[model samples]
Target: FLFSLQRKSIVAVSFIAAFLCLIIVRLTNEVTFPLILNCFGQTSVKWIPFSNGQRQPLRAHYGYINVKTQEPLQLDCDLCAIVSNSGQMAGQKVGAEIDKSSCIWRMNNAPTKGYEEDVGKRTTVRVVSHTSVPLLLKNPEYFFKETNTTVYVIWGPFRNMRKDGNGIVYNMLKKTVDSYPAAKIYVTTEKRMSYCDAVFKKETGKDR
Candidate 1:
């Protein structure tokens, strides 16, 4: 009877070990493989193909020298503060308050040095307009190179956003890239800008 009991216990332990091994193998096949592939997969946006054999130009084609090479911004934060360039923020002594957030956002080449009492010194992101490109380019070394390290998201109309080789702002950015290699800039596509404008118009009854 003692011998039989020992044999039963050994069998149970072996069966349990086999079951755990099977589970680990299944998980690796189903979950781990795909995750590994996704991690190292091609991250660049593919050009759209047309029936007439012409392919839609990518944003990189518009003269964004390092745009394609740039990795997408990944945020994992609990709080974010979007600070716009509105006149109302001029007098507010909320710099200390704004600095508390995990991420701080500002807009359109706004000066933060003198206005540090109102606006915080830490700039996580900057939302720039198409019209502001020329101004930013004029002092790229100060804004983009020397002092600020803010991520810039430039938005504009279809003509300026398009990658059709005639995009004025796109050309400007291309030239800026040649001039300033250290700046981090991302320009929005025409379709995305149009959608945002439509949403803004619907919400405020005014064109963006």
Candidate 2:
């Protein structure tokens, strides 16, 4: 009789434990889903045990956000977000940034902190077949040619703290050498700031 009673106790305890687990998971789901549903593609989260019966929050590392570029198409681009997790998740949204959390919504337009970088290694400039660009931009003497050179460009001030804020500088210059193999290219600043100037001169054949 005692053995049968012990068995029933064990089964009862098991059922209660499972029910408690379900409750915890449900609460976590409500907190993580409705708050982060539209942001990224998240299928599920798996929780694990820690020391002292403590449970760690589920971690979804990748595929959190997709940043859409501006009007003109671009290859080198990013987005930004705000995340907060200090037992203080209320008050205001903007106060909490995304990088702070294990999740991210989009890439930002600022550089990271503490890195030696250059200007030309910052943002990107792409060239395609149908881009409203020009070929030989002749301004009096110099014939600036935009040949079969399509690329992703990044130019930076190199300091993470830009515009008086913290940022980082990462130059993704692989597109140029990889895409335009054997295409002699010069990414020069003297290269007009606006495409309007380049195209106008090309159409008019005018000097500076």
* Candidate number of the best lDDT: 1
Q: lDDT tens string, model 2, 1-208?
A: 9999999999999999986776566444444443333343434443343432545444432211111111122121244233222324333333234333332321112221221121111222222111111222212012122443322222222242122234222111222234334333222121222453466679999732
Model 2 residue runs over 4 Å out of place are 1-7, 10-43, 48-55, 59-109, 114-208
Task: Please give each candidate's TM-score.
Answer: 0.65, 0.20
lDDT of 1 at 35: 41
On residues 114-171, what C-alpha lDDT tens digit does candidate 1 reach at each position? 8888988888877888998888877777678845677677888878866678889878
Please give the CA lDDT of all the candidate structures: 0.70, 0.32
CA lDDT, candidate 1, residue 3: 100
Q: How much is the lDDT of residue 186 in candidate 1? A: 77
